[model samples]
Target: MLKVQEIREIIKLVDQSSINEFTYETNGTKVSMKKAAENVVVQSQPVVQVEKEVTAVQPTQATAQPVQQEVKETVEPTAKESTVNFDHEITSPMVGTFYAAPNPESDPYVSVGSKVNKDTVVCIVEAMKLFNEIEAEVSGKIVEILVENGELVEYGQPLFRVKTK
Candidate 1:
């Protein structure tokens, strides 16, 4: 059984951090705590210390690492929020050679500052023997086109940046 104060501290850690799991151990006691997934699970495990002739709480070699692990795990949120940007990521759906124009002499499909509709052809990506016309899925203004013409592109590579209106 855990004290009320311990439960409150765990709740606070979960709310404040992006950490998905935490574990603490000292001597004979080990506590494993994790956040709820899909807002439906709250589970806690507390290990009871067995008291015998020796009453001192002496940590064994196995339990020594948990304290450091907990601290590292808890600080993950602040680090992640500072680094990741989820906005306006345009990723390739297939592997191909990115072509700005349909043919060598033809004009390019669209460039920066181009206003695109859902059916607008953004660029041409050649896969195998077929020249596939890639369309704009979102109706937006093109902020930037990331890939160069005649460049080989892998799956999920960003080719353009369109600002959603």
Candidate 2:
């Protein structure tokens, strides 16, 4: 178990780092936290992935060109660079158990370094007897994963953060 001070420190660190997500495990206790968007969908099938429409939680869209330019130009000056601190958190649309891979022996849908687009199948969330494919709504690199494979996830729970240009 973690002490109250430790938990507070972790929260502070997450905010300061602009990390969007963080996870820690020690002595069998694990805690995952992420800054999530309310309407981000974390499941999509490959066939229908391109057509999936998500509710726009925020009525704003950041231009892709400038964001990319800033990232490239600032990367050399600072390690963090112009990497947008914003997080596009892919949350479970419904309750289910998260599966990193299609099956135990298969490769995972996405990993830390995976570059994903709106149609990328990030993971599967199995609910009841059906498996849902989680899609990324933006183009970016996965910066962090918030849930463990086979862990139970609730509706609107964050699964990963994509670092957009």
Q: Indicate the residue-level lDDT of 91 in model 2.
A: 86
The positional error of residue 96 in candidate 1, measured at the CA in angstroms, is 0.9
TM-score of each predicted structure versus truth: 0.47, 0.49
CA shift of 72, model 2, Å: 49
lDDT of each: 0.64, 0.66
| Model 1 / residue 144 / CA error / Å | 0.7
Candidate 1: regions farther than 4 A off: 1-87
For model 2, the superposed segments whose C-alpha errors exceed 4 Å read 1-86
Residues 52-119 of candidate 1: C-alpha lDDT, one tens digit per residue: 34234556887853322211112112111223222364667876667899898998999878888888
- In candidate 1, residue 84 scores what lDDT? 29
lDDT of 2 by residue, 10-101 (tens): 55544444345555444445566676753221221122112333343333466333312111121111111234354688888976677999
Highest-scoring model, TM-score: 2
